[model samples]
Target: MKVSAEIAGFMKRLGHEFAQPELLVRALTHSSVVSPTRPDNQRLEFLGDRVLGLVMAEALFAADAKASEGQLAPRFNALVRGETCAAVARQIDLGQVLKLGRSEMMSGGRRKEAVLADAMEAVLAAVYLDAGYAKAQAVVLKLWGARLDGVAEDARDAKTALQEWAQANGMPPPVYDETDRSGPDHAPIFHVTVRLADGRSAEARGQGARRSIEQAAAQSLLAQLEALA
Candidate 1:
């Protein structure tokens, strides 16, 4: 099959040309578009996740020689999280190349954070398979860019931070509840509220799974608390 000009342009932005061009096609295909002959990116995404984790771990280790594993752990989590991956995907316009089924397209799958993030991971695996680990590393490092530079300080887990703040004030731990779930199953939006013991609370919306939405709600509450302080 011929690679479309759009895919070609995506390859240019991704900074890696595939030796096995079909892999690029597979990486861009969403599970929603399954067929007997066409494989989706799920397998590739699984492999890419591992590759991303290893790269981030090594980078964090070298960047901060004095940081304890406790410190590095959050940073590592921040780097490989779906939100971060989606952010990087947005930066590179990865959304422009995603291949979704009709139903997914109608639901705005291209713009969904979870979809984009998974596609980004699959793309990384495509690069790894087409070239090698070195090339894949180069693509990831270049794409991640400044995120790696500021990861240490920005990596503070918002949920952890907010919990500590509550405990310091002798309040019970925050409670998070999923207030609502909307959209299709493949691309749900979670609305979560984080409430402190004293009833001060805030809600936030996030795209993807419930855990990330909970984290986002905690972050939102923390920001409001800081503003009041």
Candidate 2:
């Protein structure tokens, strides 16, 4: 009951409210929220994933009318990915509004990338179901439109984007060296340091090799750029 008010307030910021409020409730419920007959947002998450993809594709295409498919695909992938969505989801404070079982809630499940990202998809699907495709598109665009504004070949990945920006501006591409790795090989936490050619550096962590390198590169490049400015 009270969940409705919270969600309504959230959707207002998100620029759309649900016509059928139950869909929004289910969207905010992780799989941990279960009952004798009803399930959680898993199915809606599945549907929402497709909806998000479709909407993102449309956004990518419309925004980049001149980009080749090969070029557009990766940029599209990066923009709509789990990490990006989870980042955006976290920005919206979705975790605060999510409904989860006590065990999951206590274990930081709401902030988990998979949960946050999937919940975003579920919310997208809920919007779609409530008001159909166009309104859903409007909601998604409002959230991600600025990101789509100037996509290009150089804009493939943010990590890549930062690297290219550095290189073009007479800075060396940041170097990502593994500082340490922990946990099992199958799921290791990598500590990577990003060193600039100009004797500056920074570090960041990521769950896997490519991500670690990218994040480290981003941190170093961002720091250098900020300092220069």
Can you tell me which runs of candidate 1 are displaced by over 4 Å? 167-170, 177-193, 203-217, 223-229
How far does residue 6 in candidate 2 sit from its true spot (Å)?
A: 1.3
On residues 1-229, what C-alpha lDDT tens digit does candidate 2 reach at each position? 3445678788876678666888888888887878866569999999988988998898778776898888888878877888778877877788878889998887777667778889988998999999999998898888877666755564466577677776887987767778888865444677777767876777777674457356655756676778888
Output the lDDT of residue 168, model 2. 88
Please give, for residues 1-229, the per-residue lDDT of candidate 1 as tens digits. 5788998898899998777899999999999998999999999999999999888888889988999888899899888989899989989898888888998998888888889999999999999999998999999899886989877565778899999999999998899888899987767888999999999998889667777788878888988999999
Pick the TM-score winner: 1
- Evaluate all candidate structures by whole-model CA lDDT and list the values in order: 0.89, 0.78
Clashes of each: 0, 0
